[model samples]
Target: MRKQKCGVIIIAAGYSSRMDGFKPLLKFGRQTAVERVVALYQQAGVDQIILVLGHREDQIRPYFDNQPLDVVVNENFAEGMYTSIITGVAHLNDEIEAFFIHPVDIPLVKRETVKELIAAPQQLSKGIIYPSFLGERGHPPLINIKYRSAILDNKQGGGLKRLLALYEADAADLPLIDEAILMDMDTRADYQALLIYDALEAPNLCECYAIWEKHKLPENIRRHCQKVKQTATDLVAQLIDKGETLNRPVLQAAALLHDLVKTEKNHAVKGGEILRDLGYPKVGAIIAVHMDILVDADTAITESEILYLADKLVKNDQLIDLAIRKEMVLNTYHDNPEALKKITRRYHNAEIILQKIQRIIG
Candidate 1:
């Protein structure tokens, strides 16, 4: 049988006095810093996330409520980081195949980073996977079930660092452009610095996609389709929630086929041509808007509309829907409020298209 599968224990229990009071309450990009890290593990496709809360559990818990997660309090958190790790891991059941020991304070985690750590079936036994940035190992280390006992035992001192060295984990750290993994909000200065960097760095497409394909995508068109599906499906859900039943066939086909020509001619027209030749003619509109800003010509948010929306919302080639679920897109992209607002409006537009599709569902 397959291994039980891994789970994540993100220790957010610390007071973060280093950053002046509780910094977990701080915003990394769009959501609370903790939410950013939590979304990463969720993207990694872990079984669950247990957010260990302490000093400001009451304040922090409010943001992540109703999300698929569990919250635990570390009464003895001030003693050290090890206690919170112990508490979080100890509460996990046997179903957890491994433990991803992380903290909510580290904000640079990208979904692809987690995928990089989990992609190798090679030596999970020997040690954990660390997504390295320029040769420096980052936070959120992966520990196999075989190492659970050791993690619990070594909680007496030195925290995860000591435990990793003691076990001599077979480590593989890949370079990344998602700097949040390497950056942590330890002080107001650190938080401000990252925010400044976030503003200055205008999202390097090649760099981001290079890491994304290597870590998250399957080296083909699968990931592009995956992102598109998530976007349109999410839009359809919004319609259903608003009392609509979208066209399942069209939605599924268009979301997947929208980006058929992305890596080749890099032309939306070419994408449509490819889809037409492939016998998926209905996706033409979607391919037409693959690189456009908003799929608005008429009132319809075509599959092209949803596809274009999905493509833009992504950062580092990972879905931004789940990330936006807990937080508004406008929060972090404030400087580019127009951009985020356009994205939000596109979502609404997609909802409209889905609503029309649902009307024809009969």
Candidate 2:
């Protein structure tokens, strides 16, 4: 089948009055906010891209020099964001089947989210595909080019949100697991938080559960993960009180998602790979070693250690003594010598972690 021709309109014309800085030029890791947004669509194979600039256009215009996308100036940008949308939609190529209107302030949206939106219109006959996270709609709604005339002709009192409401019957909400879809930079504090979130590369608590629902994890595994998360939380509180610094969020997310691929062979590694691909390398690293982590006299009491120990303490959603857990493991593999050897090694690793936790908390 021929690939759908996708395009994007990145509106970067708003005054940074609330942000106290240029929203498009702010650095998010290595790239500026606008740069990141452009790269997102470029990587998603968007055939055409038009950036609408108005306020401080000169400052942001040079960034896209010789780039693949066309840059248009929205002289009436001060009128409202709607003007920029009209400018961007007018510049879209005639052959473009559908397009997305993204704002420069929402730079952290995952690339996977774009791909999903691009693919949604194929299965469902919808004019607009709004990405909804936890029932909240978010930026960069993928719009069918058929609405180009309606948008250009719109003189409504409200902005795009209000105008789009008229076409609700023709629109469909595509539920996604990306929390970044709902995140945007409206103030300095929000920008700082987004920077930290970008660095951590892990999902928030709500997004983690959304992932579980998206993957359709069995009810039993979900219960087990909840208990593991609780166990890790207790360990984090105790460890923090003892002057041992640990990343509680990373540890808890790993604990909850460690068994993501539990029904598959080599589930620990598989689950880790899945998370790493989803942009949570830190959580992935912890889950990767949850099944059989390396421990020694020099091993520190980090988040990985906490997760490893917490998982061992929980047996099928119930916290059990490490000794009883080991006994059950041994009995399960008693008839197979090779399996027994691996099980014994895992138990030994769990004991070392248990001892370290006891030493810290006591």
Top candidate on TM-score is: 2
TM-score of candidate 1 against the unseen true structure: 0.55
Clashes of each: 5, 0
Best by lDDT: 2
281-353: candidate 2 lDDT, tens digit per residue: 9999999999888888456687887888889899899999999989988998889999999989988988888
Candidates in order, TM-scores: namely 0.55, 0.91
Determine the backbone clash count of candidate 1.
Answer: 5
Q: Candidate 1, overall lDDT?
A: 0.65
Tell me the deviation in Å of residue 126 in model 2.
1.9
Task: Report each candidate's C-alpha RMSD, comma-separated, in the order given.
Answer: 15.9, 2.3
Residue-level lDDT of model 1, residues 213-298, one tens digit each, is 43343445666666766766776666566655445455555655555445667567875664454334566555666654443344
Q: Rate the local accuracy (lDDT) of all candidates.
A: 0.65, 0.90
* lDDT for residue 153 in candidate 1, whole number 0-100: 78
